[model samples]
Target: MTTTPRIAIIGAGPAGLLCARVLQLRGIEVTVYDADTAVDSRDPGGTLDLHADSGQIALEDAGLLAAFSELARPEGQAKSRLDQHGTVLSSFVPEEGDLAAPEIDRGQLRIMLDQHVRPATVRWGHKLLSATSLGGGQHRVEFANGHSATVDLLIGADGAWSRVRPLLSEAVPQYSGVSFLDVRFDEVDRRHPGIAALVGDGHVFANDGDGRAIIAQRNSEGRVRGYLGLRTELDWAASAGVDLADTASVRRYLLAEYAGWAPELLPLITDSDGEYVNRPIHTLPAPLTWRHRPGVTLIGDAAHLMSPFGGFGANLAMLDGAELARAIAEEPSTDAAITRYESVMLPRSGELAVQANQAIARFFAPGQAPAPDHEAEHRRYQEGAAAYRR
Candidate 1:
């Protein structure tokens, strides 16, 4: 008889939840723990383009592709590059019926994954505080709520600031010298017609001469999300005289910064109505690998945190979850499975981390001549198209 491992997955995000679902389907008993009080306790952030080999494959493995397709915005696969004056520089739209990396709201994706798991399989309020090895192929995990669990396997799907990472590696995420002020505009076409026209169906990228940029995306429900990118010190935001907590103040400050630029681009910041979120990008050094340890492993951002410049964070995380589950299903022992998983995952994630860091540096490179080699990117898009065709 095959032995089923008792696995504990931390974090209820896409990686962790999908890991649990995949393992359970393979006849393994899995439990998921998350810090949130409820599933919808926190906003799930912006939209993501589920990549073909990574995210889409994970969803297919979990048997959630149909539901994901229903929620995915396939028709929204368009991109535009705008100058500071809101002039369209370059624009590209996929042919109708194209399914290459269709975008999906983070909230809807989470809900779809949540519905597939059995009731009570996830303990919502269980925030992991620490983990310790108990020998005999078991580990003890302590939660913030004064609860603990002893399990044969522990998978850390927690994000960049994962509490579970310290057990395996001494590495921590380091600032990438770039910060983003997240902004949102509601009723885009109705309230901000000009901005809507600027951002069209998918995304718009506006660059300024002062090492600042604005990336805006048209999300579902006619809402638009914007990320005001600034290449500044970690504390530069405070010196900019903007109230980080107040949306209006943030909008005003952004408008002032881009005062001389295009008025059309200002609405993305000036007309934003939602709360401003501060995201200080961080990344781990390249070739981030750890020694093989029994009873514990990590996936997603916990394993390889990188800058979002390449837009591979979510896709890589989902791929990690899927690969790890596949390894566990193939091996007879937990130690063997984890070892096999890390063997393949370490090099793969390290390469991606390098690519992500390089992408960030190139984006901020002095003089904005066309971004690096489009060969790899074109290959990715083609693969995505093939997946859709399948």
Candidate 2:
């Protein structure tokens, strides 16, 4: 007789939540532990696109694709690349009925996924403190809230700094020498007309070819979010006298750094509405892997964290969750399930992680021509997306 293992998943992000949902549908007992005090504890920042094969497949597996299609903005797939002077170097507007990779606000996607999972499936606010082996292929999971449980299988979907990763792999994410100063503009068409036009439908990219760039995306509401990216030290903001709390100072610093940039692009930096958030980019060394352990495994960023350049992170994470759930459901034994899951996930994510890191460096290459071939670059991304869909 096959014994079902007691499963604990550490995270409530899309990956963890979807994994739980899939497992539950198969009548498997799985609990997701997350640090968030509640579902709305934090703003799930930015937007994401789900490739048809990876992320979309995962949603299909969980029976959330129909719901997601209702919430997703298919028109938000429009994207453009511009020079420092706000010249549209290249643009892509999807043909009608194109659903290759529809864009969705991260928050909305979370809400959709959250709706499908069982109530109490996620133990919200239960921050993982540690996971200790109890021998006999059993483990104890302790939470910061003083709660504990023993499980026969544990999956770490806890993201970049996963507390559960130390039990399986020694690799930690390292700085990628780039920092993004996150800023937002609200009611864009009404409050910032020029910036709205500059951004257009989907996404806008303004790169100076010297490691300074602006990446902005339009969200569901009238809100637009962006990041002023720079190739600098991890402590660039703190060491360079840029106070995140002081919006005025932050804007001045960015303006000065981008002094020669076109006047039309000024609103992207000047018309900020709130405190600027400093995000230092980090990634695990590419092609990372771990020897299979008995009862512990990782998924998503916990397994392979990479820059967002390749736009593969979210889709890959969802794919990992879906595939892992299927592996567990079909395999004769838990160990066999895990082995099958990692065999596919590790290699797939590792390849994409390495590609993402390379893409970052190439996007922000130094001494780039003033008018880079954005059309070619956009085509490459489209091709890559198509391949990923397969």
Candidate 3:
């Protein structure tokens, strides 16, 4: 008989929650840890697209895919692209009833995953501080909330700045010279019809083709969220004397920079409402790997962080969690299971990281020329699925 290991998952994000759910489904006991004081204590962020093969497969493993369909927005998968002059360059609409990929609010996903797990399985409000190794493939983890636990298997599903990452790898996330200024609009259809029409029902992209772009997407509740992307230094905002909190000042600065763009698209910048956030992209070096270690491993962003340009971060994280749980359930030993999980996880994430690096460079290359297909990742998934069927 295989050993039953004590599993402790740090981070109650989608990855951790899914991992715990799968393990429980397989009759394996697991616990999850998170810092959130309550389930909805914080903003659950915006919408996310879950690819069929990755995110969907993980949900299927956890037996939640059927319910997900009831809440998902398949129509939100459509997307359009525009040039600086706001010309409709290209667009994509998934065929009717295409389950290939669907959009869902991040909050909804969190609640769904959280509800399926065993009640009290996740110890909320326990902020992880550090993890220390105990001999024989065990680790003792300390949390900021005056709590601690020792587990036979420690899984870190925490995001980019993972506290558990240092124990496994020394890599650090580096700035990618790509940044986005948060732009949001509430009641888009009523308060901002022009932006609403441009956004349509899905996502819209407009690039100056010279290292500046505006990407907007329609979310639930008549809200729209987007990013004003620029290939600029991390300090560009401060250097330009732009206080990101001041929307008018940010709009003034962006308007000057995008002088020749279509007048109709200007509102995406000037009319945004809500908090302005300057987010600079960062990534752990690609092909990020570590020496085989027993008792502990990582999944999701903690294991391999890549630029969001590749559109694989969230999907991959969910897949990692599900796959890892299955490996552990099927393998004879904890050490053997961890080895099996990392072998595939490391290579896949590495390949996407490399692609993301290239895509980021190509997307912002200094020219008014057409850029790489924004739908490249989606197309690749379709092609891969087709190839698998043959």
Which one wins on lDDT?
Answer: 3
Give the per-residue lDDT of model 2 (tens digit) for 1-390: 078899999998989988998998888989899999887789788999887758888888898888998878877878888878877877788778877678899998887788788988889999999999787667899998999999999999999999989988899999998889888889999998887887777889889888899999988888899999999888776788988788888888899899899998877888877678888999999999999888888888899999998578998998899889988899987788989999999988999899899888887888553333434544555576567556
Q: For model 1, which pairs clash?
A: none
> What C-alpha lDDT does candidate 1 achieve relative to the native structure?
0.81
lDDT of 3 by residue, 299-350 (tens): 9999888887756888899999999999989999989889999999999889
Q: Rank all candidate structures by their lDDT, best first, as comma-separated numbers.
A: 3, 2, 1
TM values, all candidates: 0.94, 0.94, 0.94
- Tens-digit per-residue lDDT, 161-264, candidate 1: 89889889999999998888888888989998998888788888777645688998888998888899888888876887777887777777777777878867
Whichever of 1 and 3 has more TM-score, that candidate is 3
- Residue 306 of model 2 has an lDDT of 98
Clashes of 2: 0
Candidate 2 clashing pairs, residues 3+ apart or interchain = none
* lDDT value for model 3: 0.87
